[model samples]
Target: MTLEGWIVIGVIFLCLVFLVGTTISIDLVLFAGLAVVFILGIIPAEQALSGFSNEGMLTVAALYIVAAGLKETGAIHYIVKRVMGNARTVKKAQLRIMSPVMVMSAFLNNTPIVASFIPALERWSRISNIPVSKILIPLSYAAILGGTCTLIGTSTNLIINGLMIEEASIRSLGIFEPALVGIPCAIAGFIYLFIFGDKLLPVRGSSMDTFQDPREYTIEMIVAEGNTLSGKTIEDAGLRNLPGLFLIEIQRNERAIPAPGPYEKLREDDRLIFTGIVDSIIDLQQISGLKPATNQVFKLNAPRNERMMIEAVVSRSNPLTGRTIKEGNFRDRYDAVVLAVSRSGERIDQKIGDITLKSGDVLLLEAHPNFVQKYRNSSDFFLVSSIEDSSPVTYDKAWIAGLSLIAMVVLAATGILSMLQAAIVAGFLLLVTKSFQYSSALESVDWRVLIAIASALGLGSALQYTGAAEYLAVNLLEFAGDNPTMALASTYLATWLLTEMITNNAAAVLVFPIALSLSQSLGLNFIPFAMIMIVAASSSFSTPIGYQTNLMVYGPGGYRFTDFIKIGLPLNLIVATIAVSLVPYFWNF
Candidate 1:
């Protein structure tokens, strides 16, 4: 290896060290890696900022908006409610539910799907009487499979597509082009999950709770006169949906009924047994239908004998996602009280004491009973034990928020907008529409992932600019000696391994230039070869560390490291072979 080659290898090694060893932001490591190269007087100055313009990065950003929209409008919930709704067995449920999850992922971005579904899936476990450990990993895997089906599905596809367009004048990625093989790949993956996903799943039961479940909810709200609920049937006022509210009795006519008669008229002062999600209950009480007992979000009036704070994520299918804390009546319904919320690394402000909750929004609740129980079965919220409640925000436009995000995705997926343009538009819309909220979305951007991508892209650029890629190509050719199929398979395997250890985006950055270089060196159609690398890079299974969606399940699903290896290895190899074999035929290498 020449000096630049050795330096590149050393930098990669350091990057590996930083990635494997510490929690420092990955973006920082990436920037530092490239800085070392720049300081060494790498190829040129103009190229340093070139990565900012890479189509892959933009695709990632735009996809977030699309995902957010999909989540907001209840588009994904169809799959959640139907296939994933009340799963009984792990494998059966994963097969049924993960199938749609995969389909949705092919259409939407991964983050929102992941963030929205993790909590929902957790809840689904309790309802189905299945252990959460069994399905969470599969949930993530399904998302990956789904993403590989379409060009707009995952960032990896977008990156490769962008590179292809730039280098080969391919115009744009076809919507169902990847599906040519990705469909079969998905079908095979489902089969693989059915056979092995269960054995590899972590079996986390519902009893490992860090907080208590509350008993009663004290709420204050005004009874709307002439409303259908007033002076009608006693059972008509359904408080089951509200949060933090338990109707011991109605304090009306200077009398309280521990239990109101079924035929008795509402009389505008009827109190009902309403319990469950805390935020929904609180917000509901402030509205006209129910008056607050006092004023402060109807905070628990009586002092508790034992109070504990527990954090919980809203499971993907948790019925609690769309409703507010007030609507859920959490306290009265479930005997628990909510204190705060955290979503996408952003806190819920505006007195989350009275705010509605969202999926993936972490809630801090003060309750009783340290033992773990599956509240997810009855409600959409889960009790989290590790992280504390973050601060809150003021933005509140659920419908519009969902819509704005969908717009960006439609444009990009349809090829009306480039991934980069789509991403820039999505980010801008996120800020303008207040979907992410000013304070939270900025904080939620995952700067580490961003920087890591930029730096890795720089390294890839360097390899291409410095003739290092050519040298590597020459070496690969020498090794191949003459067998193109063997060379193609080897290249595919190399990308698969790299992706298993690094983010798919990073792997793409490192692999694409080399793929192009090798294809050119071989005097073969660069498109097919690039597609092979692309498919291989995107299909990194066998490890949770390879993908963010996979890692998100680790803590929640209580999964171990080996679980991924056992299940992912087979799926990974199978997809790799399929891609390598099919690409040459599809693009005619």
Candidate 2:
């Protein structure tokens, strides 16, 4: 090994040590390592910074906009609601997410599938009271397992297949050739996760879990006619298990059903009274079939989609302080409808129109985004602030977002466009069609995840450019001696280690020629070696940086570096054992 190779290895090792031992951010840790390699003259400036322009990295960025479009239009909610289907337990939720994801991943690119699911699953986790950490890892793993089943399932499979086609002597793989071993590995993975996931996955809670809002407000919503929630029971409608919110009663045309049972059916125009904190109220506003009972919300000047939720504290000097909301012409006077009011952490029992505004009472208002600017310094209130992500969902444009996603998938799958191109088109469609705002699209992207991915790619480039990856693979393969089976195992181990250390595609590319050389020298068929290489490269469990999907979920799942090692290392071993044992049987050595 050269001096540069040794330095690259040492830098990567130190990065891993810091990642496992400290709470520092993954992006910072990885970029720091890349910087070390670049500064040491091991890799040039262009090679070190190449990851920022990587197709895979930019594809992830574009996909974030696509996912954000789906989320902002409330299109993802329909998919999540159907897929999750009222799963009550952590195990059930995992099953619901993993089963279909695995199947879908078999035919589609797993990256976008995992991308679309991350936000939806986070929302689902909050609603279901299941920790996000428990399901995200399963989601990523399921996608990876499924990707190994078919030719188009993952890029790694196609990369190896492309290499095979390039060689005149080597036979190309069939569409389902990998499935022979892939299916058994997938089944093993499913069994392992189903049986032990609940215990093995961490139970880290989101920020919303720790903070309990002291101020509770009573709000009323009407079931819109012909909406999805109408004619469904309370439980079936998903209104029964809302966190920090409770259904106090359902007001029918003439009668009131207090503490409505879970099985009680909701009729159109049924006024459902809920007592909850501001967060849950915001959640309720997003539901497609539910609308604030106050007609004043519709009387606002700005379009519903353009408005936002604001909190205003009433001042003694305000003219409407002593008057009932309806009597004070609140909507006409302030151009904002009071959704709910909180008085000293107590719930107001009166209807929104009937509540008498008092000094120091906090008001949750729905109005144009400028409401804060207009009244923040005015004597009309004490403090005024707009809530983040509180805009009304653009439900009307949901189909546009949904169709754009479908188009992206079809275009990418059929080779009409590359994944990056398809994602770019989809994101563009979303912006032009107003399905998602450009500002929200920009905000929706997790810059940290993108930076981390690019940094990891840069590190992978350093390994390849420094010849560190090749040196390590050669040293490891030399131990196989004259045994073909031992050589195959060594190749798999080498590729797997490289994958954990760098990007899977880079690992496969670096190991491909070496494995081929070994096969030629041993006077054996290269088919088995190729098959093992495909599986080893794609089986990037054990570390978050090993796979794109794993990194996609790292921050969202609130996982540490050790979290991947603890659960994924075992899965890696299981899949590796299965792949090695079955590859030679399926393809002759």
**Whole-model lDDT per candidate:** 0.59, 0.89
Instruction: Give a tens-digit lDDT track for model 2, residues 192-310.
Output: 99988999888885636744766788889999988888889999998999888899999997789999999999999999999888877877887779988998998889777778899
- Kindly list the per-residue Cα lDDT of model 1 for residues 430-476, writing each as its tens digit: 56654443333443344444555556667666765665654554455
TM-score of each: 0.59, 0.97
| Candidate with maximal lDDT | 2
Q: Name the runs in model 2 displaced over 4 angstroms.
A: 206-210
